[model samples]
Target: MQKIKSIFKTTGTKNGTYSVGLTVIVIAIVVVANLIFGQIPEKYKNIDVSSTKIYDITDTSKELLKNLDQKVTFTVLAEKAGADDRIKTFLSKYSSLSKNIKVEWIDPVLHPSALSEYDTSANTIVVACDDTGKSTTVSFSDIIVMDTSSYYYTGNATESEFDGEGQLTSAVNYVVSDSNKNIYRTTGHGEATLSSSVSELMTKNNYKVNELNLVMDTSIPEECDLLLMYAPSKDLTEDEKTAVEDYLAKGGKVMILLGETSSADLPNIASVMKEYGMETEDGYIADPSRCYQGNYYYIFPELSVSGDMAKGITSQMVLLTNAHGMNLVDPARDTITTSPFMTTSENAYAVTEEAQKQGAYTLGAVAEETISGDSAGKTDADTSENDGESDDAEQEEQKTGRLTVISAGSLIDSQITDTFTQLENTTLFMNAVSSNFDGVQNISIEAKSLGTEYNTVQHAGLFSLLVIFGIPLLILISGFTVWYRRRKA
Candidate 1:
């Protein structure tokens, strides 16, 4: 009986020893981890800093922060309600970019009168110089798009697709640099008025909006940084063409837009557009895939996108229209890269029908094309013209190369916007036009704030679902399995 009791006790002792050993191992691991990671900061606990990625910094934005001399302060006056992880994340990046870039998230809600320090709204940014701590304020919603074109897309202009190039760098330069923006809008030939919603967007950004009457004045204003040509009637006189060419030659930025009128309708203006490798057909575009199936007036469709200015805009377009449009095909060689930044469905095609019936394939349209007008310039003319068809007046038509040709009429005019919102295309076209000019870096950083859709990187709704829920559930399931196995063992 004594031997049996001793054996049982020894067996219990062995079990106890194994348990003690396992506990000791876990404790040792915890101690070592704490030592190596330096007792993880309280704020960063649970957030694996090892998994945090440092965005590849551009030389421009990099050199900016690196060479910064003063103790710079970032006063973010975001309303606490909409203040999000995105702003926080970017703030962290800004911190990483420069030690001088001090970021303070100010809550205007908590202390309503705190805005008096900067004498601005809560949505404004007060960027102070590191040297004297002197500051300048930019709006919280102030946007930037980096594409080199004169025009930048903001507020909800539509495009067919996306490009990953970090155009934000240019906007960063604009924000940090002392350079002021000079945005020019061209008027004549029944263009949309500047006081419209699109023009108001510029005003909100504190840009000086000037209406350019190149037809009347025959010269681009000296203070101009970007020139915009909204949908125009066939009215660019020869003097207007020469003035435009001269402005572009001197590296001045510009934007041009067209409506439904064709080369046939606006012979003088058509000559300019044709020079840019854009040719307008006589009619319109109609497609079941691109049009409202049951509704004859609703023309909702996906346009095409490419780097080609002739493509007009980008794949990021979402335009609403009652009638579709006409387009410009690159009538030039492959050296002219017509970036398919935007495109319609393959089922769509241009229609040559006139005075059409409801059932007939008919909608307004335009396909813009671009070509080299100079070593550093692009023109709209490349499509061949009928030699015998040239008239004395047609011979003097001003030619446009790297020019944006529009085949749609209603989309460009404001009166018809009642049925469609080419406002997206309008913004995009002007942006492209402003960008078409050579050498002037296009600033588009604020474009990131265009919406959460762009912020999501890729169909973010789906990716977010996976990250916010699926991944955590997977981990929980894995933990449960581990616990179950341990109990069984």
Candidate 2:
């Protein structure tokens, strides 16, 4: 009996020692793992699990952060107690994207003299870059958008969206950019001016908008990066046309939005577009199958998603009214390539004054011409003796000119864009203008509507199967292994 009791005591001591050693190893492993993970950035570890993904930034923002060279700081002027939680969460995620970003939450009461020169009030955000000494201030109303559309009837202003990401990203982009792209709109022809919303969008994308009268100026300015002929009712003058032709010869960009007029009415303007293989028809397009309500003229055209114009445009539907049918003067050209980005279906037809024509038509198209060699503008006979010179000139003369033509003027109207909040008419126009600049990215992120249920994942077949079947199968295998080991023992 004494020997058996001693054996039991020895066994108990060994078991207790093994248990303590195992516990210590587990605790050490956990501590080391936590320390390793703590060193990583918060963006990689913290997943946005919110239903609306309020804290998650889009791929557009990610691309901007990847190319960020200068350090940008966002200074929020609000006390910690009174700060908006949505803004705080977004800024945290934004800062974690790059080491060049820093966010500071400064209360005006505590730091009375800090940033006194800026016109900042409570809840205003100042995004500044010390390298360039440039700063942009975002007001409280810009961050948190309010919808007063219903207030006129209900007498209560409701919250529309938290657009903190859009505002802050645009602000950062403005201060970091080297210079703005100068866009000169043609005036003195009864052309429509850009809407306030469109003008503001242009400003955010670092485009300086100014008016230019071709008759008065006689030539496109040297500083003009893009020329805008926005739905001009009258044709260009003889000298004006020559000036435009010269600008294009030396590599210039032009965006032409045609009004509801025939090619015969604007002969000089038509001639300029004809050089790029784009011409407009007499009347509007009528798509009976792709229109809204019973109105066949208010057609929803098909979008070529593979085109550059479709980049960064999420919402697909665009409303275009009083649009002319587009035709290519030369469908195939070795020097100029013309492709339509927006077209109508086969069943659609154009309604003209003469008669209705049944055929598929183009509503928007882009024409690009690459002029190379010394004989670019010379005739075949003139270049017959200069083959060697042309071969050498090919290396030096590689200039490209682009012309973007949209069929409708109403596409940029304020009533269409402001009324149809769900449609992407404004975004489409913005993307078209932004495609000219090589490195510029258009920021047209919409404000997330408050109190709306967004079902992001519509189809989760694989996820459903894993949750329903995979978990129970693992449990069964674990239970069977434990039972088998105990029974054998």
Q: What TM-scores do the predictions have?
A: 0.49, 0.75
Residue 381 of model 1, lDDT score: 47
**TM value for model 1:** 0.49
lDDT for each residue of candidate 2 in 1-489, tens digit (9 for 90 to 100): 999778757978879878999999999999999999999887877777766666778777787888889999888887877777777667777888878998888888888666575676777888899999999898778877788897998999888777767777788888998777999999998898888778877876778999999878877888988899888998888999988877776667889998776667889888887788887766779988888797989988888855456766776789889888877888345678887888887777788778888778888988887765355556799867776675556767766777888888888888888788678887888888887776665765655556566566556898788889999999999999999999999
Q: How high is the lDDT of residue 13 in model 2? A: 80
lDDT of candidate model 2 versus the reference: 0.80
Candidate 1 lDDT trough over 10 residues, lowest sum: 159-168
Clashing pairs in 2: none
> How much lDDT does each candidate structure score?
0.50, 0.80
Clash totals in order: 86, 0
In candidate 1, what are the lDDT values of residues 1-489, reduced to their tens digit? 999778757978779878999999999999999897776442243342322122333343565567666566767787645764534554555556666666677888887777987788976656665555346665534422233332354544432212111322332343455545677777776776643534533533335677777767887877877676765655777788778756655445545545545446666565544444444445445555655555423344454434323232333444434333334455444433322233345565454554542232212222233322232333334223333444654434432234333334344445533233323555454445444444333232213223223233867898889999999999999999999999999
Candidate 2's C-alpha runs over 4 A off are 1-56, 117-122, 146-161, 305-307, 331-334, 372-397, 450-489
